[model samples]
Target: MTEDAATIPIRPAELAAFLAARMCHDFISPASAIVSGLDLLEDPTAQDMREDAMGLIAASARKLADLLAFSRVAFGASASAETFDARELEKLARGVFGHMRAELDWQVEPAGVNKPAARTLLNLAQMAGAALPTGGSARVRAVEEAASIAIAVEATGPRARLRPEVLAGLRGEGPGEGLHGHWVQARYVNLFVGDAGGRVFADVAEERVTLAATIPA
Candidate 1:
């Protein structure tokens, strides 16, 4: 076994803090853009560039909305035993993916429910979103099992980075290299799945990375 094969449960509080910080960082960019757009809207000559300014404002507002909704499902406190519509979750995943410049190809079942399953899907969506740098397709699907559910994220993109340590962390392994935001996210994903008694698998190659998780029924 190599260093990347060790398994460890990450500190939940720390992982939550990291995610909060990341969300804040991303929100700040669009928030600033919104402020700038507003300032421009108030200008006497703004009417000449009304279309452009309005576009900027709309884009920023959408980004903020996506971030808030996604973060709520990912890090916020919610009932773990409630039933949530799979279609609704799929829509949420699409919203999160919309913020990216990637070409996404997703297929989700009509309707389903399972809080753990929903959370797992959300994590998978976010992780796959990060893997695609040059904008590739991400496909997701879910199936009900005897006493659980299986969720998968198959992504293809240029410059995909699924390092061994990061993969290890996603598999409930020890702390991987924290050099990148993706790796940090992987650690949290690993912990979340592990805590729910689920497992994550990854197959990373030259131009593709596939991640999947199985959660209890």
Candidate 2:
């Protein structure tokens, strides 16, 4: 796809707002669950349900923690670490997938990768998971090819589908009449991959969605 061809521009401020909203959306559910569990603990009448409340608190805490760790590397600067270990990346990917309906299958060839590649892998993997709402498999693969690192994620299962806004974002275009949360992620991926002098691609078919990118190594 041509970069920014026939694309509506999203200002920096708008992009930041959309990203912040997206992250907050992901975090709120677990956070709210934790709060609700605390409320139940303080209620004397609810003492009999303490066990259920505790379970909710524990699970919500874990989910929140997992999302936080994943978000750091996937979206934040991650404390100036330029390269990331594949195993650690896999752990992060699996952590997020643990709360999802889909399963993660990571098969990365490289031992480590730079920040852009790391973000690409994590984002694409999560996107793949999102594509399979009913439950499916998201297979992530990365390999060193010549002077570039190739990353691909194939999401396949019953009812798997790609959103139109995601396709637009992957093509470096703004989301038109679509949900900004989903759109911003693909747009962010497109921007970073392009900044690294690479290209991004996406394809959607019956029960399958594929996302791929190539970044300079």
Looking at model 1, residue 213 earns an lDDT score of: 87
Please report the candidate that would top lDDT against the real structure: 2
Off by over 4 Å in 1: 1-10, 44-47, 77-81, 163-165, 173-177
For candidate 1, the TM-score is 0.84
> What is the TM-score of each predicted model, taking all chains together?
0.84, 0.96
Q: RMSD to the native, candidate 2?
A: 2.8
Query: What is the TM-score of candidate 2?
Result: 0.96
lDDT tens readout by residue for model 2, 105-175:
99999999999999999999999999999999999999999999999999999999989899999998878
Clashing pairs in 1: 6-173, 7-173, 8-173, 148-217
Error of 1 at 168 (Å): 4.5
Q: What local lDDT does model 1 show for residue 156?
A: 84
The global C-alpha lDDT for each of the candidates, from Candidate 1 onward, is 0.74, 0.94
